[model samples]
Target: MSYIKAGTDVNGNDVKLHYIDQGQGSPIVLIHGWPATYEMWEYQLAELPKHGHRVIAYTRRGFGNSSKTWEGNDYDTLADDLNAVLETLDLQDVTLVGFSMGGGEVARYMSRYNGARVSKVAFVSAVTPFLLKTDDNPDGADKSVFDDMVDGIRKDRFDFLQSFGKKFFGVGVISHPVSQATLDWMQSICQLASPRATEQCVYAFAATDFRQDLATLKVPTLVIHGSSDDTVPAKVSGERMTQYVSHAQFVEYSGAPHGLFVTEKERLNRDILAFAAGGTVEGTADRY
Candidate 1:
């Protein structure tokens, strides 16, 4: 891994983004979910490269070692920050992967920058299309959920994460319970983020609509979600998002929780590798 650093312009206002570059060949950029730093994708960072793909995973603006400012935590700026990293590195034929909140960055990237120089896109248990329920979006998540999230954090961040972390991995799910170690590690990462970023992003992810972006994405896409995902249920997010994509391959892990990356790491990695390699899947987009 190269030395960790942030990019800055003439004014030094700070385009603070930190990422790890590894391996050789086609690039795969992994954007982490909410309340998680680059460390969350440790498995992908370590395993994907062994298959000969250059992997890049980064902490979003306020997570990990990146600068944490009071404002500009919105999705548009987040997407711009991601694009800056890609453009600075002059990456091409890249496979952009977004998980959970990070998925917003992917959608915004394609919508805002027209996915400049991107090859493929993927979402893992992401929040997209539209998360918060509204007049037209009847199946969406409730605004109260997001409000409660901000409430929880403002009330007591560390305690809130301890419980939020449990819901994230579906601790009591009988089929596949996430290990306690993973849950604790997840909380650690979540707590590492700027509390302000964590609080503000709740409003961003819940309110932002990506239906337009998803419809216009002119790249092969992968939509992976867990059937039992409690946070961003597949029915509202991944399942519904397929309708917007022109050419998409949807994979729903049966009874899998939202954090399938940890619960079902190996299978998820293979699916991602296959998607990046242009491998075929039996099911079609319309099937979802």
Candidate 2:
């Protein structure tokens, strides 16, 4: 039930972010993807601590137990919320990990804050560089795709989430990476978020360009993406990220989906542990 005040909303009411701080060592801040709470890092929270790394994950302003605010769902405010966590905890030499939409926070935070308090970063199935396809960014997803997402949310939020969760974890008739109960649990977590925040964040992650922000990453970086990710294609985000941060170590989870955090948790944990410890990650370069 620990909380950190992330400024205030339009009504000047304090926007408190519920967070989980556990373990003790060099810190790792875990940012959950869209439509999820800090609870999404349940596996990491348990495993990372066993390895002696302090892990912190927080619910975003409009999600979970955090204050449901009408504003501040943008990347700028989201990055500031991350800053609040780092500052409040007085963490140093940290490894910041962002997944899916959470990756935008890591990218924006580095650029906006000049990489303060962090020595390394990792993007797992992230939405970065840019997601919305423009005339200049032909490799990005078409705007209509995101438009449909927003429309779906508006028309039937819960139904959309139920469907989205399946695609997220690569759960289909022939391929069930996660159980039905797991999907149910995830949907429950998504329901904890404010509908306004959920809808607004779609626009944020869809349209926000992080190309300039990627240029600001001077720290050690790791990029992991599933080759089968349909949510945020690696070709668009993770693959393009290495072009920006040329020194980043990239790993492609062969046949993995966007929800590799769950489907490939053991491998993901190993890679993260290796990278955080400054050890060589056992993987080949991008093989596409």
Best by TM-score: 2
How would you encode candidate 1's per-residue C-alpha lDDT over 1-288 as one tens digit per residue? Answer: 332334553456665677788899899999999889888888888899999799998888877777776677889888888887788788999999999998989999999998888999998999988898999899987888889889989999999999888878887655438777888888887887898999999999999999988887989898899998998899999988778885777888888888888888988888888889998643334444
Q: What's model 1's TM-score?
A: 0.94
lDDT by residue (tens digit), candidate 2, 54-126: 9899998999999999888899999999999999989999999999999999999999999999999999999
Clashes of each: 0, 0
Backbone clash pairs for candidate 1 read none
Would you give me the overall lDDT of model 2? 0.92
TM-score of 2: 0.98
